[model samples]
Target: MSRIPDLPGVISSDEIVASAEHLAGLQTDSGMIPWWPGGHCDAWNHVESAMALDVAGLHREAERAYEWLADIQRPDGSWHNYYLPDGDRDMAVEDDKVDTNVVAYIATGVWHHWKCTSDRSFVDNLWPTVERALDHVLSLRKDDGLVLWAVEADGTRRWDYALLTGSSSIQHALRCGAAVGLATGSPRPDWVDAADRMCSLIANEPLAFQPKTRWAMDWYYPVLTGAIEGEAAKIRLADGWPTFSMEGLGIRCVSDEPWITASETAEASLAYASIGEFATATDLLRWTRSHRCPDGSYLTGLVYPDKVVFPEGETSSYTAAAVVLAADAIAGASPGSDLFVRSSLRPS
Candidate 1:
């Protein structure tokens, strides 16, 4: 099977490589993948970009990106919310908090790389990091099984309320972490149970999470993370479609805005595909072509009506990563293609 993803007329393997290369180019020598040239690097998006590199057959670069994470991981297995290219905590944004979802995402990235390469040694090496990270995240899980969004840098201050988007993502990561553990001969049944609880909370206890109804991520992430699936997932998408999607454009960053974001649209495509709605998924992936830049990097978002690029010429590595992942989900081009769609509770 092809390691690289393609969408025929929509996007070619070469175009996917170009986008992956664009993300690789943005990587600092230390292997940290920032959002943009000088933008902050969040753990979640940084891992996402690394996964994209692996999807495009850039395994060496992807490994380096993971090494960056290993190098900077805190003692408690958590990473600060944002980092600079120079490898320092970014206190300027969100006061350098440690987001539970951000810390948990390393498991997803590491698992994706393992699926692409089948490298047991790599998974073995990273297993401890993944273990610690997920353990740290689960340590903060509330009685309802939903994790709080973030904690202070010192792990002293807490955010108190849970978030639907972040907790949903954590649910996915926990399962991925369990998968990684099983691969390394170290199964984590507790993590698996935690994931199931989080999934239940996400699927049944909407009020448990802080209200982020305006954000597009809040609308699609549960489905994207596989916390809600089957007919329920389809119905959720249909219910949110009118509010989040823009015909012939892309999904909005916020329901109340006309601004269309590439990453959000790409992720929504993956969510739709996970539920067997390939036609809707393919169309969503196609819509992201509008954000494609000449250099294969994706513009962050576009303001509708006039279709002006917002953030003034911003092209983010994470945006390109999302597009690459979405294409993989739709095309089933690689072993890792089903990473988002497959059940993380089982072996890949």
Candidate 2:
């Protein structure tokens, strides 16, 4: 039987499967999972959805989603920031940008799928794609080891600053990439070294990246990515709790905003679980139920005082995906469950 995450009283295996089904229902015929029925797709969130599908035992659908990425990958191994459901570039101002974190995420998805299935042939097939993607990401790293946030569609002009959340995510991807390399007998020590440097920067040099302290992702991503762990991870979450968390309603998207997003809450839960704080993680995850829809989809955000959906009828595949991933992390039933919890995937 395919392993499915079951979080006991918090969430049943069947409910998690239903959530994946809801997300899968939003996927295009070409295997592209959009934010919603008519929404745009981004490489990062698309990979996130694919990971969730794997967690729910939707292996065929998950593999198909990865194939969609392989089909659309740009020559430079990066994808545009956004694509329409029909597989055309969105071409909006920032939509055409190539985000390093976005490109690096394929390694995470591929590594997670490999863990879920132990499919060495599948890893071999996708190895080149992950290699090219991370290679392109490493090429963009600055002298300080932090990567630039993004580049123009031409892949020539680049952003001057890096983002804490984005770079932290890239670090996690690098570790996942190294794990994939090791499994395929292609051992990428360089990728592992780069990931360690990035982790050091994230742990000690907060000023290395652009300050988006107001954003919930910036507050939790270091822990979520395992860039910060042990007592340090606990301290970080506690420090940000008052600012970003909203008691029973989930966490705010931005520190000052009354709007709470399910995605952020779910991911923060994973961060807590990574540090052995399962009770706290479960509480944060239980809060996400406030935004859950009847059909197993999650609302993007709910504005407090009114409890209105901020995007106005928005339920994103990524938000639901986050919930699935968090449940898996807590349940510890899938092979990929430790992908986020572990500080490193490298062989000891």
Candidate 3:
């Protein structure tokens, strides 16, 4: 079988060296991939870094990240957005997020690591953790098919409503859960319903989450899942492209005001590929990979600190997650695999 390669822009000798350097240089001593020296961690960032470690074949380092999540997961199957270097809580949100989606993200992480390394122990060990977390996340779903925004880390409720990004994110995670459920020999009807309900909200209703903003993440993610597919997705995607996209740089998390966002662009590129816009997707990925360091890590955002300023530094997790998902779509392993050039997931 002809397998896909790891890391985008990694072809020539120099590119290979750069990827190796980027991968090795990006690691922290604690084995938990930090976004930046003094930065906080979120579910998205953690999962992104773990996938990046998988791309680099740093399985142990990657496994540690999954463990980091397992250790810190709240009793109610969610994670706080921030954690201090000592593995203690740092900045706590006023209300805890019912991070069922993020909690379910580990299924993708474990599955990706298993495919890359074929490590059965890693997959088998986390079965219960995955099971219980999904159980709790599923507990909060509403009759209209919306999941709650979040709960307190201590299991208190956070909000009575749902956020668009949060709902979109969890929808993807629920699909990941289905995949995990299939893998573990214990599939749940609730998970399938969660995926189907989230899809219905995305496809059938406009007011699924918060009103649709021009954030590129919001634009393309529905396509990444089976939530929005085919030509309708293309229109929904292109409709918002001009508002936030720069021809070469990336996207802004929101439209109208604020600065551009690299993480959003990278992920949006993956979403674009889901709809088969290979040219646009690769261009964004190339611009992103071009900005990468010799060590294979990438800066988190662009136009930060101030909109006029250049991006600061490696949100290895962000870049890593983008790379993996984009690559997955490209390589045809992902549900929306029709997006990539080959089956490499590296659309560019």
lDDT of each: 0.88, 0.88, 0.61
Stretches of candidate 1 above 4 Å error? 87-95, 343-348
Tens-digit per-residue lDDT, 194-290, candidate 2: 9899999999998898889999999889988888877898899999999998888888999888999999999999988888778888999999987
Model 1 lDDT per residue over 1-348, tens place? 556787887789999999999999988888888899977888899999998998899999999889888877889999888877653432234347889999999999999998999999988989889999999998887777778888898787558989999988898898888899888999999998988988888888888989999999999999998899888988999999999999979899999989999999999999988887778888999999999988899999999899899988888889999999999888888788888776332223
Tens-place lDDT per residue, model 3, 115-233, is 66656677767766676676777787777888776666666666667666667667666666666666667676677777788777878787757666756666777776547877887
**Residue 234 of model 3: what lDDT?**
85
What TM-score, computed on C-alpha atoms, does each candidate reach?
A: 0.95, 0.95, 0.81
Winner by TM-score between candidate 3 and candidate 2: 2
lDDT of candidate 2? 0.88
Candidate number with the higher lDDT (2 or 3): 2
